[model samples]
Target: MENQFSLAHLTVIDSPPPEMTYLAARAGYDFVSFRPIYMGLPGESNYNLAQNKQMFKDTKSAMKETGMKLLDIELAKIYDGVDPKSYEPAFEVAAELGARHVLSSIWTDDRNYGIERFAEICELAKPFGLTVDLEFVPIASVVDLAGAMDVLRTAKQENSGLMIDVHHFHRSGDKAEDLLNVPRDWFNYLHLCDAPVEIPSSKEEMTRILREERSYLGEGGIDVAGVVDRIPNVPYSIELPNIKKTQELGYEEFARRCLQTAKDYLNRQVKT
Candidate 1:
């Protein structure tokens, strides 16, 4: 089950239902990521935490019917200056939902404090036996691969490491040499998404590009297959934010297409 592929919360964050498990299952996904219904990123629309308990309740119920477990709890929407004590509730949520990992990226002004913060978080998550997956996003303050590794190393937490998303992987300026640099065991989870050749100028533009122009792995400009071939095997999840495309097609169709393409690509790599 560690090799399981899953759907990211962003795919269906807007209209999460108790039946979301069914959608992921029918789409052939192995798990569903938690975006936490009410939490939003800075300057974005915010959903009050009042709805989190209900959404958590709904997600738990849905998993019972569909058998699609919650893969991870996303901390993407919660950025810097979060109350250190406030995360207690999130860990509690992850534990309740059978989530193994809590994922998030932090900003850089407090880079010196990241290791300490990570150590504290790891200790908190450790009591629940839940680990943390850190992703480096350009928009985030700690925006580089080196910065991420440094944080992990300084924190010295075995329970916390990186989750590589292809979009972030390439954009972070990781070279093939970068692939060789990553500690195999450190990449605990991964995401596969694609964008066309155009380089996005800003975070908002990047989101728009991914949402509008990205295609399934083999169809896009990203050397995803190459990257996958090089990295040590880990759980890879499809995280296309093609909301614009979904307006024309349904989730299941797009998911099936993406998964099949990914599976086919990986299968071929295996054969070779």
Candidate 2:
């Protein structure tokens, strides 16, 4: 089967949705991921398509022109005091863009609260035919496969699934072999990227690396092939965010290389 690749918003986050969509299509990707739901992080631009009508229209125009589909929308964070209903507008926009998955993560250590909030998100997304994929980030509360799996199992939301980002998977110390314990149905897609073999020693350093310096596939120490080999066939969202490289090469050129390197790595994996 041919692998479908997505130009994740983070890969060329500097580009707005319309521009990113065109770039992804021109770079030869089957799909594209967008961050229409604003995370309100420092240095991050708010594309919030739910509220930005002009940007949303332009983005839709690009998608229609390029025939590129929206793979997923991020991120519905399950943190303390978050109202799951707040994501409804984003969910409505996702369905309008034809996206089927909504990415989320556990931000607070309160497991029970996280589970309840995540379940609420799943329910809210259900009307729009979107699945809430719980991604375990090394910097977040659900920092490993076990933590993410436990939430989904306990929540028992049919519209919920687990999202594995290879960089986070390795950083969190979960082995590729550990994927064996997760049910096949829980996997719908993967966030693909590689990082240096040397793990960061502090949360701040780790956060910086994840947001600014992720290595290209096969150029880093991650066993990307090993992890992908264990999961079901699904779209690979290349979320490689290298600030310096993007600055030097520009978003279009960087996005093209990201997709090319991913294909090269996957092809090599097939031959091996």
Candidate 1 lDDT, 170-260, residue by residue in tens: 7777764576787888876788877765567788987666545566766777767667766777667788767666777777677777778
lDDT scores of the candidates, listed in order: 0.70, 0.93
lDDT of 2 by residue, 1-272 (tens): 78999999999988999999999999999999999889899889999999999999999999999999999999999899999999999999999999989999999989999999999999999999999999999999999999998999999999999999999999999999899889999998999999998889999999999999999899999999999989889899999999999999999999999999999989987433
Candidate 2's C-alpha lDDT?
Answer: 0.93
What is the TM-score of candidate 1?
A: 0.87
Clash statistics: count for each candidate:
1, 0
TM-scores of the candidates are 0.87, 0.98
Mark the regions of model 1 whose C-alpha exceeds 4 Å error after superposition. Answer: 1-3, 41-52, 76-80, 211-213, 269-272
How far out, in Å, is residue 77 in model 2? 0.5
**Residue 228 local lDDT, model 2:** 92
